[model samples]
Target: MPTDDLGGRGERIAAAYLTHQGLRVLDRNWRCRDGEVDIVAREGSALVFCEVKTRRATGFGHPVEAVTPAKQRRLRVLAQRWLAAHDEHAPDLRFDVVGVLVRQSGPAEVTHLRGAFT
Candidate 1:
């Protein structure tokens, strides 16, 4: 499959994984002027802005490692904008990272790291 296809598949898996973890998914692939958040879910009163990173291999490192400081800043900015537009009652917000490791065989492994960074 093409790389983008694999990425899309990974994102789907990550979303399902988060939902299974008891998060109410408010949005997926949410984009704003600053950036995009792969998954937006509510964990109790806190709104979570999630970044999904997937890789077939982790030779470099885990997928979450790819979320640089600049990326976190962008996510935070976008999350604020997202809340301003749709949420009537802006709740406490946090950032998360869903790391997906996809293999050719066997089931994929998804790791959800809450409050990964600022």
Candidate 2:
């Protein structure tokens, strides 16, 4: 599969996983001139912004490691844009990273890191 397709599949899996974990998915693939946010969700009174990274193997490094400081900064800006474009509010804000590793056998491995950055 193409990298984009793999990433899309990972995003779908991550969304379902978050829903299963009781987070209401408010948005997916939300975009702006700045960038795109993979997922936006609500958990209790907190608003969550999530980034999903998918890889077929670990040779490049853990998928979560792909979320560098620069990416986090962009996500913060994107979050602000998302908030400005909508009326949703929350007492708390969180940034999460969902790393998906596709395997040739069995199910894909998912690792979720909550509050991954400030």
Candidate 3:
């Protein structure tokens, strides 16, 4: 599959997993002048901002390792933008990451890191 297709598949899998884990997804692929937020959801009283990364193999690194510090900073700004654009508010805010490993064969493996960053 192409890179975009792989990413889309990972996002779909991540969203499904989040739903199964009992989160109420509010947004997906939210974009602004700055950048895009992969997923946003509500888990109880906290609002979650998520980044999803997918890989066919670990040749480079683990998928979660893709969320670099610079990316985290950008995500924080995007979260603020997202909140400002919406009326929704939460008692807590969190940054979460969902990493999907899709091998050439077998089922895809998913790893969710809640509160992965401040």
TM-score of each: 0.93, 0.99, 0.99
Task: Evaluate model 2: give its lDDT.
Answer: 0.97
User: What total of clashing residue pairs does each candidate reach?
Assistant: 0, 0, 0
> Each candidate: what lDDT?
0.86, 0.97, 0.98
Model 3, position 112, has a per-residue lDDT of 100
Off by over 4 Å in 1: 88-90
lDDT of 3 by residue, 1-118 (tens): 9999999999999999999999999999999999999999999999999999999999999999999999999999999999999999999999999999999899999999999999
Q: Which candidate, 1 or 2, has the higher lDDT?
A: 2
Sort by lDDT, best first: 3, 2, 1
| Candidate 1 collision pairs | none
Root-mean-square deviation of every model: 1.2, 0.5, 0.5
Q: After TM-score superposition, what is the CA distance of residue 29 in candidate 1 from its true location, in Å?
A: 0.6
| TM-score quality measure for candidate 2 | 0.99
